[model samples]
Target chain A: MHQKIGERFDGRVLDGGAPDGMQTFLVEPDLIVEVCRFLKEDPELRFDFLADVCGVDHYPEENRFEVVYHLYSIPFIMRARLKCRAGDPPKVPTVTGVWRTANWHERETYDMYGIQFDGHPDLRRIYMWEEFEGFPMRKDFPLKGYKDAYNPFGEDIDAGGRDD
Target chain B: MTDVTILTENKKPGGGSKEVLLNLGPQHPSTHGVLRLVLEMKGEIVSRIDPFIGYLHRGTEKLAEDFTYTQIFPLTDRLDYVCPPSNNLGYAMAVEKLLGIEAPIRAQYIRVMMAELARISGHLLITGALPMDLGAMTVLLYTMREREMVMDLLEMISGVRMHTSFCRVGGVREDLPEGFTERVAEFCKVFPQRIADYERLIAKNRVFLKRTKDVGVISPELAIDMGLSGPNLRASGVDWDIRRDSPYEIYDRLDFNVIVRDGGDCYGRWDCRMEEMRESTRIIEQCMRDMPEGPFQVDLPQVAFPVDKELLQRSMETQIHHFELSAYGFKVPKGEVYVAIEAPKGELGYYIISDGSEKPFRMKVRAPSFVNLQALLGGATNMNYLADVIAMLGSLDPVLAEVDK
Candidate 1:
């Protein structure tokens, strides 16, 4: 699987060694859409099912955030993970065109981590309301949530507990 | 974001069929929970349907960052309260994967039994509730009566009816309660007859037949394209069940059929869940017989409390170990893993990334209802009446708590 995708994308496909028995790969942000399209359309690697897409907020790291896609091949009964790292203004090209299931999953990733999906048709907040302030899933966000009309006091997160 | 305006030269204000925007809920009962759907209706048929969710959002993933792994189990129970044990099992398995440990064989058996029982209980509610929307409330009363039996068994083992919170990071809270197996065995035996009663009442009924048969057909390709799972995917003729294909825990050892239907209609989805109830019964019966006598929880003291009561009471070292483990939760290895189980609704998954700390770095739930809820959009609800839309939504069975989570 690695050699096949590697030959196509060359240096773009970086193997993210199998963790917990899951085969993971780190793809360049620019190539993710094309790569996902190939994985879905290709006969052998027919990863037709986009199981989930979620964001990971790696605050204090060089690449601050990551957009992770969990793909599954229904016919082959195989699973693979794709990760794309994003910087300060986290943005990754949308795979909505490749797999329609990416529509909601990408919307959710944007809503949670405030990571923008470039070219996503309906890129709007999912779980949170439109006017909600900060992304609650970010590492810097307080655990008690933002203070609004409903919640007067957010949370007293200690200075030491902010980072690891 | 395309808004199509009719430029017909009828020339009269408010003449011809005008598009009416109808808001179905954030409060309506038939929606099952707090879900608001904006329906663009032209005369009687819906032109488009947009589902506005998050009315029940509690930000469980955000809350999980501060809480320890042990503290996160209860939050999972709230996602799909109909089947709390399944949520518990998925979360427990994810945490165990991170910690690089497996629960005892006996505990795996216990988890499978509870999960299948949870499947049965959940199927009963939806199988009944779908018909209830069509003015068949008696089936709900009957199905709920059966659901209570499954709940009684869970309460017997875990001592809680809805949110048991019985699953620990490594394994279950305790062994099966006395007489619990006997009660479940009895339920497994009599439950098939109860299901037949429901099938007879609704399956051949003329009203039920007309309304559900080929009403909301989702093609196999579209079902996979939308990432549907469990009975929803199976009903679309996709023979995929995470328990069977992925073989999580001892499911590979268990013998049960993955119910599949080629009909791909509202009736097929309903009938698929009905057949699954029987499969779940078979699974529960198998777990009861094959379950071996062994430790319920893993022996690892870091993840679970010391198993021996005598050692816990007599030894100060053991007590101190317990205090430190509980008070300041033990650290897990730094890594990330996503573990999905074939839950009643679909694939209930927990993706956890640990920074080698007591609390997880990031925890994301790939909630089945959240993804499956998207199917209500597109042609599934479009061009259908308000009544048929409700039937379609009911067939999908999206739990709002999980959807908004």
Candidate 2:
């Protein structure tokens, strides 16, 4: 499938091989929608299902954020992982045109890692409230999280403990 | 601030339909867990739905980053709280895949049995709850009684009813207790008749059929587009079950029919689940009959603790291995893998990235409920009555924990 895709889209999509037998492809952010459309539209490889979209925050790296798309070809029963570096502000073009289900998964990636889907229809925080503090899924974000009255560290310490 | 539509079909000279805003907040019982929907309604027919989720988000993905591979097992249980074994097995298989090892043959059969049993338990809830959502009360009572049998079986096997973190990275925590298979065989013997009783109660009932037969109809294209899985996808007549299509574990060895119905409505979803439960019983019986006799987990002391408890007390090397495994869990090799199991709800997956560390660098749960619930916005529920929304939700079977996670 990667060869079939690589032959058509020439150097636009590069194979990211792993020890595990998961078929992975690293796509350029700008040409992702094109590649995804090609992958879905091709008669032999109908990767219709967008299984999931998630963000990986690689702190201090040049390309800070990586957005991973898990796609499944239902007709052929093959799976592919398309990843693109959503560089500092973490913006990647939406594939909602290819598969409508990317809507909520994109919203969730935005909510968790602050990555932006370029053409998402109704992009909003699907999980956290609008007024929440920071992207919790980022590597720099503290695991203890912000302390509130309802979620006060769970300790009977001084009330003056600073919020991270 | 919201766009409103007029019901032109019932238009009178001046006004036949007035748009109303209904805030079915988190408190609505039929919302299942904490799902808030902003429904744009013209009288009773809903035009558009804007659902507000995340009330139950616990940052499991973020939390998993700080926990070890073994510690992450309990967290997966909470995603699909109905059938936790499937989550456990999915995670276990993912870690094993990364390590490039397989759990012993006996363990694979046992894990499959557990997953199928969890599927039955999960299907049992929707079988009862979907009807209870539509105003029938007795089905839930009868189904709960049967669910207790599953719970009892789980307790007998894993010592827990709900969150049976029985599965470990290499394999299961322990082997089945004596007489467990006999009780399971008895369940397989009696469950088919109980399914018949359920069909008598509601499958043929006129009111139940009327409420669900054509309501919330999902076309095969829309279901696949919106990423519906498990029984929901099968209910729409798309024959794409991961168990059959992509065999994980010993599923290829086991023989059972994948239930598919062309109804593509709430009734079809329910009917699919009922047929699936019967298939699950068949699966369990076959797994037990051909059950292999060998070590449950692989012989990797670093990955999993030894099965022999006496070795920890008696042998010095065993003690050190146990101590290291307990103090700090095993370090997985530097790689990433995504393992998805056909969970009762759908494809429950865990994508784990290991930076050659004790804890996962990044872990993302591909929850089925979250994607399946997105189909509600695909116009199936649009033009549906406000009450049909509940029926649709029940049919979709989106557990809010999995959705919001």
Candidate 3:
């Protein structure tokens, strides 16, 4: 099923030797919406399900950040992933127009890693407030969240007990 | 920054310039963990909902990159604190996939048993707490009682009630303890009756039904499109279940039905999970009966610690393998694998990228709670009463630990 759809989009299979056994496919960001639409509408490739939307930062490397979409086909019992690299402002074409679930997932990707999903309707931060300064999940973001003295866990327990 | 002015204008003002932006958490209960929900509210009815997560972000992924394969096992436990064992299994399964090694039959059976038990506990947390969120405090005690038994069983097997890093790469860390079967049998024998008691206590209760029945209604197609999984998706009448459909571990060898209800409401979500607890008990019983006798771990001296006494005592080579496995974890071949399991909430998958190093290149967690939590905005909050928001949140039962991580 992936092969049939991959052919339609001219998607190239990643080197099988890639780490984690992820069968990476490079889909044109523009064609992503159409490809996804076809995948959902096509009978053989009814990937009517969107599993997850996540962004990975490959900093100091070739690709700055890659937005990955995990799709599952119930009828075919197959899974496929689509990826696109966003270098500067970290943007990927939103699939929310195709899958409503992408509304929050794409927002989460944007919230955590500062990736902008173009054409995402209501692209507000899903897991972060509007005032949050920077993306928390970026490799550059510090692990300690918001270095102010106020400890949320301090109300339930002491501040010093929890450790690194 | 370009869109800042547009956002500000659209931000519905709460009470004409006196709009108090109240930070509900980073410590609030409804936020689940340390999620800070910035509510621009006039009173009880919220004007706007801005959920701020990452308060509990421990950088486990970055830590995994620095640590060895074995060292990352314990870290997965913290992701979904409600179901640590499931996270442990998911991580172990991903690593094992990279190494192209399947655990022994007995080990697989034990892993299933542990995972099922964890599923029941996770459901109990949601089921019991949903009522608590609805002001039915008595149900919390009853559900906690059931959860206690599960914790005790976990302690018996893994030596910790929570965050039991019992699951290893090849198999579990320790064998099932003596009389573990009989104890499990005792629980199973009485479990069905307990489930009935719970059903009567809340399933048809007037207040419970009213708060949940039509509240948080998520359509099947919408749920699937939104990436919802586990009981939430099951409530919407989607017959997709990782355990039944995909069948990893020893799940295929057992007989159990995926509990599904078509209401797609908060009550339906609750019903699906309540039925799931019963089904999980059945799976545990089947596991006990079908468990085979064999080596617990795989025969990989490089990854798994060798048990041969002669090698440790007489041969230096055998001792070196054991020392290396413990001190400097084995390197998984350069491969990327996405392995998922039917967790209590949904399809929990671990995507591990290993470049033939002691540390992983990139590790991504397909957390169910994170995906399911999106229902708060679309299904529950936008269409229901303000109080229904709490009921729906509790019903969705997202462990913010998983979401924030």
Candidate 4:
């Protein structure tokens, strides 16, 4: 299916390989929406289900954020993973116009990783509080959060505790 | 906003009224879990529903970054608390895919059995809860009684009722207990009669029909467009089930019918789940009849925990290997895979990315309830009465844990 897609898009595939029986392709971010549109519309490769859309932060990499889309073709009984990258304040075209499920998924990605989805209808924080600072999923973000930040319980509970 | 304008434009000139902002949940019992539905209501009719989720979010995906593949299984158990085994299986399959290994055939059969059992218990709870939400208290009591039996069976095998982290990456935590098959068979024998009892109460009841027959109708095209999977999509006449379509685990070998309906309404959804429970019983019976005797987990000592204490004491190599595997965890090849299974609610998928590290680089759970809850936005609640929204929500059966995962 990746080869077929590659031929149809004139080798738009930046990288292609089967890792652990999962067919994955790295494609240009600009062509992702178009490629997805084709994948859904094409009769031979009707990847109808937008299974998931998530962002991965590759810290220190030039293009740090990679947006991954998992597509499931019901008719063909096949699955494909589409990968694309963006830099700081990462932005990628939203596929919501192609699949409505992308709306929430893109919002979730934006909320967690701070990756902006271009043209998304409602691109607000889906999980975290709207006023929360920083993307918690990013590699650089501390797991316990910043020490000097506001503590809702009034004081740092750990301050009085004995050190192990 | 667009919907409001359209409603006003289409309304009778004298019938135009002020739209009321009604907050349905985040506290209401019918909303199921900590789900908040901000409904734009015109009198009793709901014009739009804006679902405010995440009150239950614990950032399980973010937490997975620090946990090893083996340690991550328990987290999956928390996603869909109703059917933890299904979540465990989906996560296990994704990690196993990355490691390029398969659980032994006996383990696969056992997985099918456990998943089917989970499906039954899950459906029973949903079936019971929906009717109870609609004022049928008897159904909940009856279903809870039956559910207790299923829970006991799960506890017998996994020693835990709700969040049974029974499934491991290579296989199950342990093999089936003695006479477990017979107990399941006994449950299967009496379960159909219980289904009949449920049908008697709600199948043709005028009140049940009145509330659910035509409410929350999701057209086939709209359902597919929204990416609805599992019984919800099947009820909408999509004829797609990951078990039958993709044939995961030993589902292909098992003989069972994928229950589908053409109504595309709340009743259709209810019927699909009810019939599916019967099909699940059938699958479990067949699995038991064709049960094979062999090792449950694969012999990957490096990947699986070294459970054999005797072997660890005797073999120095085994002891060191177990220590290394336990300390550093197993290294997976740098790649990503999305593996989904037909969970009780819908397609429970695990999207995992490994950077040739002991811990997962990124883990995303394609929670069924989270995705299916979008159906409400897909016009499932549009133009319906505020009262009907409860029935619609009950039919959708969104487990807040899975929804807000």
The candidate scoring highest on TM-score is 1
Two-chain DockQ for model 4: 0.69
Comparing to the true complex, what docking class would candidate 4 get? Answer: medium
lDDT of 1 by residue, B1-405 (tens): 122233233224766577767778888889999999989877557878889999998888888888998999899999999999999999999999998899999999999899998999999999999999888888999999999998889889998999999889888999988888789889989999999999998888888877888888899999999889989999999999998898999999999998999988899999999999999999999999999999989888777898897998899988988999989988999999999999999988889999999999989899999888888877452227778888898999999999988
What is the Cα-based lDDT of residue B13 in candidate 4? 70
How accurate locally is residue B27 in candidate 2, as Cα lDDT from 0 to 100? 74
Residue B81 of model 3 has an lDDT of 87
lDDT of 1 at A73: 94
Pick the winner on lDDT between candidates 3 and 4.
Answer: 4
What are the clashing pairs of model 2?
Answer: none
* Per-residue error (Å), model 3, residue B272: 0.9
* Candidate 1: regions farther than 4 A off: A155-164, B1-14, B381-383
TM-score of predicted structure 3: 0.88
Sorting all predicted structures by DockQ, with the top scorer first, yields: 1, 2, 4, 3
What is the model-wide C-alpha lDDT for candidate 4?
A: 0.86
Worst 10 residues of 3 chain B by lDDT: B1-10
What's the lDDT for all of these models? 0.88, 0.87, 0.79, 0.86
- Tens digit of per-residue lDDT, candidate 3, span B149-194: 9999999999899999988899988789999999999999987898
iRMSD per model?
0.8, 1.0, 2.8, 1.1
Q: How many clashing pairs does model 1 include?
A: 0
**Candidate 2, after superposition: displacement of residue A149 in Å?**
4.9
DockQ of 2: 0.79
Worst 10 residues of 3 chain A by lDDT: A155-164
What would the per-residue lDDT of candidate 2 be over residues B1-405, giving only the tens digit for each residue?
A: 113233444355646566656788687778888999988877677888888888999888988988988999999899889889998999999989988899999999999999999998988988999999899999999999999999999999999999999999888999999999789989999999999999998899898988898889888988888889988998998998899999999999999999999878998999999999999999999999999899998888888898888888889998898899998999999989988889999998889889999999999999999988887785563328878888899988888888877
